[model samples]
Target: MIQAFVEGGWAMWPLLVFGMVTIGAAGRFAHRPQLAQLRFIGAMSLLTFVTTFHATWLAISAVLSYLSKLEDVASDQLVKILFTGLMESTRAGGLGGLLLIVTLLLVAIGTLRLTPKQG
Candidate 1:
């Protein structure tokens, strides 16, 4: 988990904070359902989605920049480098996706709890 965060670079920090706040709010909503908390969770999820892609793009750009500087690099080595960079880049997206899923589940539970028992 810590390794992933380090490989994910700066983008992961904001996402970490967003995820924590969102999960906390969602959990709170579940305990005491509130419209405001639901809205906050929704907004945080959206932000998380955007940041995930943004981090990926940054990583890709870095990889491209690094590749551009190379001269006469072997195909096998180039492929290895590309693969490694792409894999590292995906860490941010993976974390964001996990956070989104958890937040959504919490929101759903909160919604279910918020609604009165239909008779």
Candidate 2:
């Protein structure tokens, strides 16, 4: 159902597989029908989704940089393109700072989201 709406792309297969596997595993240890159990499953799935989003954002960022910078090069050589992307992003913000900011922001949002409900 989600794949249908999200345009699936290449990431759908991997995320679907992971979601199914984890949901199944969690069911093994807990009663999935319970609300708390469902919430946990949701949190886990959201985490996985966030990880995929970060990875994909990085990949697309790299690809765009490579394509825009490379000249007179064949597109078939994606491996070379990938390396070029890594080098460029690394040079842009030195990898650590950008990833740190992204990760910290994600953590902050998650913290706010998971805060206890007010009375």
Candidate 3:
């Protein structure tokens, strides 16, 4: 779990940075509360899903492996061999999602935080 978080965070950092810069650019071009708020909400939801899904996938494999180990089926052997493959895919997807969310969240907050004073 900790490992998942760490790797996810690391892999996500770059993309998040990119998003911050990118969204900042978008805001410069089409700054609007509606759009910024929407971007922020979308990002938070996406990151939440990415982290949750990665954790769930890991949990599933653990349960499946345990069951297979008990039954002495090929699932155990296959599971061990396929560990890297699954982890790689999950990490890639989860990190990308996480980064996008983080980026969007930053943008949303910035929009609200830096709003101009109303006349």
Please report how far candidate 2 places residue 104 from its true position, in Å.
28
- C-alpha lDDT of all candidate models, in order: 0.84, 0.48, 0.52
Write down the TM-score of every candidate: 0.90, 0.37, 0.36
lDDT of prediction 1? 0.84
lDDT of 2 by residue, 1-119 (tens): 34232432345445445555444535432421333444555565565556456545665675776578877777678667777555433322222233334434443444444524511
Q: Rank the candidates by TM-score, best first.
A: 1, 2, 3
The reply for model 2, stretches above 4 Å from the true place, is 1-21, 29-32, 73-119
Minimum summed lDDT over a 10-residue window in model 3 is located at 7-16
Task: Please identify which of the two predictions, 1 or 2, would achieve the higher lDDT against the true structure.
Answer: 1
How does residue 56 of candidate 3 score in lDDT? 48
Model 3 residue 90 CA deviation (Å) reads 0.8
State the lDDT at 89 in candidate 2: 35
Give the clash count for each candidate: 0, 0, 0
